[model samples]
Target: MSVVVSFKVRREVKELMDKYRDRVNWAEELRRFVEEKIRQLRAEENLAEILEELRKAGWSVPKGFSVKSVREDRDSR
Candidate 1:
């Protein structure tokens, strides 16, 4: 069946979430974003070797760049 997980959050954050909750399904949106980021990080083309290889075949990663960001929860206004 289903289980419920409860926690607490800041007042301002809670109000912000309540405002946008109707327009977005938070669970589904969060799941999709995380899955895509993981896939990109673990791809086979990520093995950087030669100059042309790094440019055309493999992933070109920099010192610091990531799609993921900090997350917070909100309950009510």
Candidate 2:
């Protein structure tokens, strides 16, 4: 399913957008931009929730744990 979204803009802004519309699909461009931003924001929120859950479970790194270990772990993947 799909929905329509509309917004108001200044006359100059609309004029500039119309001018660029001749060279690009501005509506599709805005849709992609909006979708990417939405995904990024949702990911951030999910990460924050996961961190909170970890904190609630008293999860913590030991004093001996270092960024080197973290980097190595990531590189292993």
Clashing pairs in 1: none
TM-score of each: 0.41, 0.77
Residue range 7-68, candidate 2, lDDT tens digits: 89999999999888889898899899999999999999999999999999999988868987
Name the regions of candidate 2 deviating beyond 4 angstroms: 67-77
After TM-score superposition, what is the CA distance of residue 10 in candidate 2 from its true location, in Å?
1.9
lDDT of each: 0.66, 0.94
In candidate 2, residue 18 scores what lDDT?
85
Over the stretch 1-77, how does candidate 1's per-residue lDDT look in tens digits? 74554558899978988899999887677678878988887664454335567577766865444332212222221
Q: Would you list the clashing residue pairs of candidate 2?
A: none
